[model samples]
Target: MTDSTAFDWRSFLLKWSGEWADSLPESETRDADDEAARQARWLGFPPASEERIAAMEERLGRQLPPSYREFLKVSDGWRNAGGFVWLLAGTGDARWHNNESGLADMYAEHLDEDSGPEERREADLWRRGLQLDVESDVTYVLMDPEDVDDDGEWAVYTWSSWRAEPPERHANFLAFMRDMHREFHSLGARQGDTGPVFANDTTRELDARVEEARLAALGGGWEQAEKALDEAKGYSRPRAAGLGDQIRRLLGKTYMVYFEDLVTDPRYTPELLPPLVAEHARHTNWDDATLRFQLRGADDELMSLAFETLDQVRNGTYRYTPAGPFGEAVDRARELARWGGSDAAWRTLMDALPLWEPLGPDHLAPLAWVADPVLGQLLTPERGRELLSTPRAGRTGTPPSPAANLDPGGLAWLAEPDRGNNRTSYRFVLVEGVHPEELPGRLTDAGGDGGGGMNGDADVHGADTVLNAPMTLWDARHTSTADQREFSSYDDRALVAVGRAGTDWSFAFDDRPAPFHRPRFVSPAAAAGVGTRAMVVWSGLRPGHRKPFFHLSMAEDGAERYAFTYEGGEIRRSGEIPEALEPTRFFGDLAEGAAAEAERPLLEAVTREFGASLPRHALTSGRLHTFTTRSWTRPPGQGETYTVVRRDPPPAQWTTGGHP
Candidate 1:
């Protein structure tokens, strides 16, 4: 069965039209008026009959992607819609050649080999493609049928008619639509022609209110949390409709945190289990760790109830009254327990088992009466700790990577390795698969630092064979390397390292190989065997250069070389001739001037969301050098190299770049 959370094309079209219309001002321009008339016409058109869609597909010799088909079933054509997306044809308008506003006809115009030089060159590449839109004379978006993925979705690209460069890619039609929608709304909002997208003062206020509720819920102040959540619902903004869900999740946290208080209260008894369990079921998505710790304090009866609820959920017999959390909880609990079977379930639970509170013998006597075997096993504090210490190895039977358990202080693991390759050499190798072989080279070119070629004649060692040792083997490696002699003079050349454990890989750097050491690193994935990439930033003051330089890179080997210094709200980034770092759209061009606090929030928000607490670089200007390695790998049991680089600035680039 398709998960309930699966994207619904029909719902999206409805919401898109409804929200777009709602946001538009009542007074319409000629364009808006024309669009409204087209909308009215399309709205009155019957949903695409299956027969019509089939006939259209037969004539076009291609099947429309599911999203487009769904759009057809709602409206025959997108008129005055899709923001800057221009037009999307429905069945009757989807014919070939010169037929009406048909999609094929639009694309066919771009395939003319007899056109002028510029037009012919522009049309050649898109001859057999699906033209999505032509927003400007220079820009045309198209879906290349030849570049379809495993899922049968074509890769969409923005073709710049005059640029000799390759077309910039988007993942698919749906993704391209989403990006265009956001881009249009963002630009429109900036120009004062539109209000904030899906959020305004009311939504922000509601979010703040929910954050307050979340805090209260965490502190066991259930009443206060519930009240704040209620207040949030009074705001009639479209986004506030989810306030009730927020309240339910808070209530779930309340149950977990104050389980003991509720269990012993005169108003409740063992019968309260169903509702309590169900309430928590609604919050299956919550990642609050405090609840996990508090759950250990639960009494025997409460523990038994939780286990019972878990069992019922796993067995498919659990039912929630009034359609509460049962559905979500069942799926969530199965996911948490890695529900291969009872054993896997038990082990999964144990991985998160907390230390039980100290209790008198009288209180402990009742634990024997508990019927859930897993619960009883967990009650023995030592046993629970032991079980948690060594979770069941995954399908590969490899223990969870030590890198997964790194603390924030262990940031040293992300430092550039001392490439002064001595025994202190943290020289690790990149095992090809973690990133496409072309990545390091491409980044090097983009940064415009041929590294070895940067200083005209300096021969630099690229970071191709860098590999990191896991914490388990760190002590041994450290002790063995303690006696290594330091090089007479450290090379000015920058060193780049890739850290890995199990299937996880990340960019890491260390100033020099230090024998006595502890290392810390963060995997961008933050999960065991699932994270595909990581990033690292390292810098120092150069001896003769007299300026501080930092190198920033992802799992991709090339690093952005820059010298940064903050002047009030502006960060002056200078070094590489081509400007290595892309200007962040969030704050515009920093050099153009901004309040110092403007970029702080963006960085802080990223840190909160992704734990990317990289060291901030304050320019002190320098010669830039970008280095990369063509070879790298650690021994097999040592660590697994990632094949993709985790894109910077969080989600937007990463999502469009096709890295999960």
Candidate 2:
């Protein structure tokens, strides 16, 4: 790290010339005249004569700042100061910005009472500041004489139109120039130019420090590694920036910074980006959690690319093939996943993690494991932490079993199987005497348009049309309303798949099956027509726990007939308990035990009595008409909140079954 106060201008300019000479490709260079001048002044021209400098100072009526004066003595002017700057002005070309630019007047018009102190200073300085850059790509570099420090160094400012705020301030000219040099190296690295940016000794020292940090991080000395890497980054060590980010991620300080860099790198894009995107979708699209660090800086083009790539991954059109033994492990894991053995698949991957080598310095093998399609879904936060903590050798144990098949006939596979982790909370609205085709229109305020939907099947139309209408309605509702407080309250938007069960039954399945404070039940007025009936069944349980609080509601002829809730070994009934519901019959051997065991029984009884049986194949493997339900348009009434007054003693059945 060179001290900015003692900056050596000649030596720095010499180093800059070596780095910038071939940093950019031929096509990226300026026109012939500009290129020739840039080459001629690459290391800067001869020193400015003291007589000539004094004459220029007299002409401008102001003495040059110490740093700029010393810089001019070493080089009259510099070329290609950085990626954006073309040339620095010598003593002859330097003058007050007000003499040649109207930027001050333009900025003055935008100032108001709300303008901050920094903004006011920026506007005032633009007119009186000494302009230094002769040419740039819409960038202005200036030195403010009024903002001098005790050392007599004027504060430097760099203003660019692309920035959102006022000009950025630097402590001195040396600081500004150092930043520009780092920018050149950063841009060069991104454009596939990985040449050395510093002297041989400096480069060797930084590289050695970065390698030590890497080893320290792998050895669980993350705090020490992070400190060393951060220090190296100040000298513009490219590997230091990446390794520092990896350390931060390992420490859980950031979520996607390292992965974000990997996705933009072409070397890892094919092998890693897809799984990373899939993992991001699992958190954003499927999980109940709000969107986090996924695609934080992505523009429209990148978002589109990610969305398309995810769709391909989900549809089995895209596959990631790792190299060596890791590829064989992934292949076996994927095969096991195909056969519904999620636990076994995850175990296989975990077993192979120790032998897996990252494709490049930027790659983290553990991230690839947690982001995998088959293995990622089964991984818990604890498991992810373990993987990140020990990147080379992940901990292994007996993983939880895959989600239990809830379909009555055991034929229904999940449409989005990755969501199976959340199957403990399930909800679906069942309607009698409504066709699957007609059900979407009744459930949503907007009628269906016969068009293909997001499921990638043209014939499956109503789901997309129905769901799209509600999003428009929600947007309009929030936009048109005076009170926007309820906007976030209407987060009940859900993906629903509509399919015919038996001859007389049709059901709409909520893809966000997780139970909430208010279940997104179809409005009785919409589902129950002249002679039709609608029923909603929900079970909210934690994974690996059988003590679910079950809810069943039935309505007929636009009137709710009965509601039954079984929770904490007690049954809360409204209206009347139907004779058809015989808990003892379904419970069978466990009839005398805890009510926690009643979930499966209740589901079985409801399936038998209502004749509600959705097609497993249609809901999973085959495409069915699906729509997104906008619960905001017709917000459902908050259902009853039950108090578990009766706490049953632990039953031997629950103990033997390992259910809590």
Question: Which of the numbered candidates is closest to the native, going by highest lDDT?
Answer: 2
How does residue 40 of candidate 2 score in lDDT?
57
Question: Model 1 segments beyond 4 Å from truth?
Answer: 1-7, 32-46, 80-83, 92-125, 134-138, 160-168, 193-417, 420-660
- For 488-592, candidate 1 gives per-residue lDDT tens digits of 111122233222212222222332432211112222111111223333333231222222223223332333323233333334454442232332433355333
TM-score of 2: 0.44
- What's the TM-score of each model vs. the native? 0.30, 0.44
Q: Backbone collision count in every prediction?
A: 30, 3
Candidate 2's error at 617, in angstroms? 32
